[model samples]
Target: MGLLSNRQRSNLIKSYLYILPAFLFLLIFTYYPIFYAIFISFFRWSTDYPQKVFAGVQNYVEILKGDLFWKVAWNTLLYSVSTIFISMALGLFLAVQINKKVRASGVFKVALFYPMMIPLAAAALIWLWIYIPTYGLLDHLLSGLGLPTLPWLNSTETALWCIVAVGVWKHVGYYMILFLAGLYNVPSELLDAATVEGAGGFHRFWRITFPLLSSYTFFVFIINIVDSLQSIDLVYIMTQGRPADATNLMVYYIYQQAFRYWNMGVGSTLTSMLTIFLLICVAVIFSTIGRRIYYEV
Candidate 1:
């Protein structure tokens, strides 16, 4: 039985039509590729289909057995952990400082946020020049101070750290914005009450503000980890996993396996592994640290 009038049915259809394009776009581009990658992981694909040789779990075995896989896995974790902690520390510091009422606060915000707007490739190029031997900014300063000018991006020991610094610098601003928003949400009454109790700045921040900001901190932590895991552009542009693969990350390694070396099956296996790894990480985070966060007043 047709119960609804023509106008009501038309509005309902239009609402569904509005969301249909976005639904289809994600289905085709994101979901399909993910599922297909998992499907191909069990085969020996060489960038061609139908002729792909079936090799169940062998690609996973090969990638895990290879020394390169473990090396990049460690590098990925190192980069992610280093960048996330440093960036969050800097971001939280900046957010707290900037949240105070000051004359030049707007200018400081803009200056800090500017770096995040720069394209990663472009930023890598600029940093490449800065890290250039002898005449570069860093080495020039070191030389001027009569200190040893170490290789920035050339040495294995420092190459990953250099990239980590770049990542921290680029990402700290975005995280600062997130923390700033959370800071604003901290209850003014609570702070005022703490103030009346003769609570000092550090006491108030540690006891009240930081606890309220746990949600934002958790979000920034997860995002930084995920982004670092998928970091490829800067590595591709700056290091290309050079200096003995010190800066090699998992995503770049996957790209190399799939495109450069044309090991499609191995690439697919890596892709699946990365997905599962991220899922497990997220689950563990929610089960552990996420339980401590308070979202409600």
Candidate 2:
């Protein structure tokens, strides 16, 4: 009896030991920071101040009244919608094209996924060079073709769209893999049935392929939106929110306010706002659009 009790205790100890590292990591990295941010959000906290004074909801009120906050929010929404739609469409198209039993399909898949492997900073730098007004590859090619070179990053009107285009180019390959996985799992019998019913190519795709890929589409949409909303590295490296802050995304603005400006209280408020917005968006999507996602056993 004594030996059995000792063994049971030892097993329990070992089980907890196994989970200790993960628990420690979560406590330090996730929970701690989350609570810390929440605590700081209600106060006028700063490195310069030895003691933080409680400001109640002043930070929130101030941020709400700030024009820059609204501007960044609008920019973030525009970027998210444009990037998500364009990436999903391009990814689905590429997935379908590559799913075919074509010559060099494996090579094509590798080539398509290559962009996703590149680091965001490196990719942005490369795009910046391509978008340069003079002596850049794109501008040079356009000039050679007798077409006028348009300002890309230099113009407020074009800067946001240009950044979105780069984002699509960089991320389309990653989402293509998601779409390809979904396409592969689609039953061949479905296509055959559609064909037997005299469904044309477009008709079969619309009636069959798309409906079956609904889950994949929905997943890609969520991921793309989240990623687009959180995007900062590429925009920071390429444009630095220049040309009248055309590309000033929410995350970027938050980083600037919090770290650069040392406006910790405002930064915390913005972070909370972003978190709430994301939660609300996710909830709405799941409650409404997510019902259309078809899960295959």
Candidate 3:
């Protein structure tokens, strides 16, 4: 019936003290900017503004009316879907190969995981050099085989895809390591039981191993979705959304609107839209995969 005892109060105070710095950090660096973005999105806030005019949903309406918006939206969707699915599959294949306890697995793991250690801009630059048309590495190889060479980053049809391939290359290693860890944790007893039941390799994988990696797959899915949505550095460095906006993506579109064009209101609206879209995607992912996760405990 009374207030907390002295020891309980002291413990509570200590817990609060331990968490206070992290909570404050998130408030300043993460939460505040999101709220501020939403605030400015509703108004005609510009670099010249000391005071702003309220615009409601006009920015959203205008963006919806534009043909370019939909073009860029389709571009973004295509790139994201293609990059994530292909990269994840490649990663899974590599992980399974390496997990076979083959000779020199340590070396193989390092080779596969090394790409993630490189910065994205640096990787993009390297791919840029590789993608140059006639004198580049790709064309050089094609020439060796007596095959005709095609424009890579120079053509609209291939520029976006070239960048997407670079993305898959850069991220596949990281996802491979994640899948490798999942494979390592797959219960030995379950595999043994499946083996004793005369289950072949494909059957064991489909019935046992793959389902056990559901959590890892879910994590990879979310990470790839976010990566795909926020991906701009590669596109910026490689193609700059050029060749008639063939590579235009939503995040880079927001960047161009906000910084290059100095249209803060529209930029903020685009930001809000991207946020909403990603949230919906996350919800859908959870709905599809949430209850299927099997904890090892």
Name the top TM-score candidate: 3
Residue-level lDDT tens digits of model 2 in 19-138: 999999999997788778878899987776547899999999988898988898899989999999999999999999998888999998999899999988888889999999868888
lDDT of each: 0.93, 0.89, 0.89
Clashing pairs in 1: none
For candidate 2, give the lDDT of residue 58: 91
Off by over 4 Å in 2: 1-24, 47-50
Which stretches of candidate 3 lie above 4 Å from their native place? Answer: 1-4, 47-51
Q: Which pairs of residues have clashing backbones in candidate 2?
A: none
Q: How high is the lDDT of residue 156 in model 3?
A: 84
Write model 3 residue lDDT over 139-218, tens digit each, in one string: 98998899999889889888889978988988999999999999999989999999999999999988898889988988
- Cα error of candidate 3 at position 220, Å: 1.2
What is the Å distance of residue 47 in model 2 from its true position?
5.9
Give per-model CA RMSD. Answer: 2.6, 3.4, 1.8
lDDT of model 3 at position 153: 85
lDDT of candidate 1?
A: 0.93
